[model samples]
Target: MRTRQSVCARKARYASAAVALDAAKVAGLALRPYRCDRCWQFHLTSRTKGKWMPITSLYS
Candidate 1:
């Protein structure tokens, strides 16, 4: 039988939320940081729902 890895397992793990958010910023304005329940670590999500505001708004 074959095993499947979870989304959390495949994604990169960040030590802190700040680090994750920073990475997201560098990656692009469309990305955001989110806490993974299983890993207890921060990861970036590309979902553009909710408060997915662009960083450019803060500057302008």
Candidate 2:
């Protein structure tokens, strides 16, 4: 059972959440690493509200 969401399918996929988070960190943007249900991979999103945000110096 493999069905990739259109929004996620066309986007980059990270093998792990750490990798995704690191990529975001390098980008120097406050991005949230979330596990995609459709792709079963990690993806970054800018939507921070109601989402877990890392209490790091970059975010702070």
Query: Number of the top candidate by TM-score?
Result: 2
Q: Candidate 1 residues 1-60, lDDT tens each?
A: 221248878888899989998887888765677777777788888776566586885575
lDDT (10s digit) by residue, model 2, range 19-54: 998999999987878888887888888876776555
Point out the worst 10-residue segment of candidate 2 by lDDT.
50-59
TM-score for each predicted model, relative to the true structure: 0.65, 0.76
Candidate 2 local lDDT, residue 31: 80
Model 2, residue 28: distance off in Å is 0.9
lDDT of 2: 0.80
Q: Rate the local accuracy (lDDT) of all candidates.
A: 0.75, 0.80
Worst 10 residues of 1 by lDDT: 1-10
Best by lDDT: 2
